[model samples]
Target: MAAVDDQTPRAQLTASPDGRVTIPAPLRRAAGIEPGRRLVAYVEDGRVVLEEWEHLLRRVQRRVIAATSGHSGSAADALIADRRAEAAHEDVSADATLAGRGAHGPDPA
Candidate 1:
């Protein structure tokens, strides 16, 4: 809290002996961090940052959508199609292996 950086918002906070810090209610409300929300903590540039997991996911989703929008297909759809193709390849390979084994006895070992 303590205005860790001028670029970030300031909040008054306290850390207990067990190394747990409580984010004040006002700060939480301002940041839209609600109760029962999941979070991730990380250190960057020698600063600790706590962020809601949903927020991170949304930001990444936006980035992905923006990155893929120029393409003629949806990212999720493309991913599903790719996975299906991979599975089909695996099925073909397995069938070929089984057929080969049936057509020819085990190789001399």
Candidate 2:
């Protein structure tokens, strides 16, 4: 076991042949994993990995909410509205340029 730093507690552990590994208390606390909590495991790059349930989805939702919470509408609705407005603006500009070319028949030069 090794402590990476004094302030930020971290440790390294090895897995046993029986597939049992001990999780350090500080690391468990930081990861929000508690006793009796359920976890998901999957194989990646020939290595077995374990992660908390709903971990990925929850993390993405947290980031989205944090980024858009201050907007006028709800986070999800605001994102949709902003995207629609951008698309509409692009369409209007495109139509205006097309109309201008048709009316003026290109540059005088």
CA lDDT, every model vs. true structure: 0.61, 0.61
In candidate 2, the residue pairs with backbone N, CA or C atoms under 3 Å apart (3 or more residues apart, or in different chains) clash, namely none
Residue runs of model 1 more than 4 Å from their true location after superposition? 1-9, 72-77, 80-109
**lDDT of predicted model 1:** 0.61
Looking at model 1, report the run of 10 residues with the lowest lDDT sum: 99-108
Q: On a 0 to 100 scale, what is the lDDT of residue 90 in model 2?
A: 62
Worst 10 residues of 2 by lDDT: 99-108
Provide TM-scores for the models.
0.47, 0.38
Can you write out model 1's per-residue Cα lDDT over 1-109, one digit (the tens) per residue?
Answer: 3545555556777766555578877678767888766665656789777666656556555655665556677778779655655565565455444544543344445
Clashes of 2: 0
Residue 65 lDDT, candidate 1, scale 0-100: 61
Which pairs of residues clash in candidate 1, taking residues 3 or more apart in a chain or in different chains? Answer: none
Model 2 RMSD vs true structure:
21.3
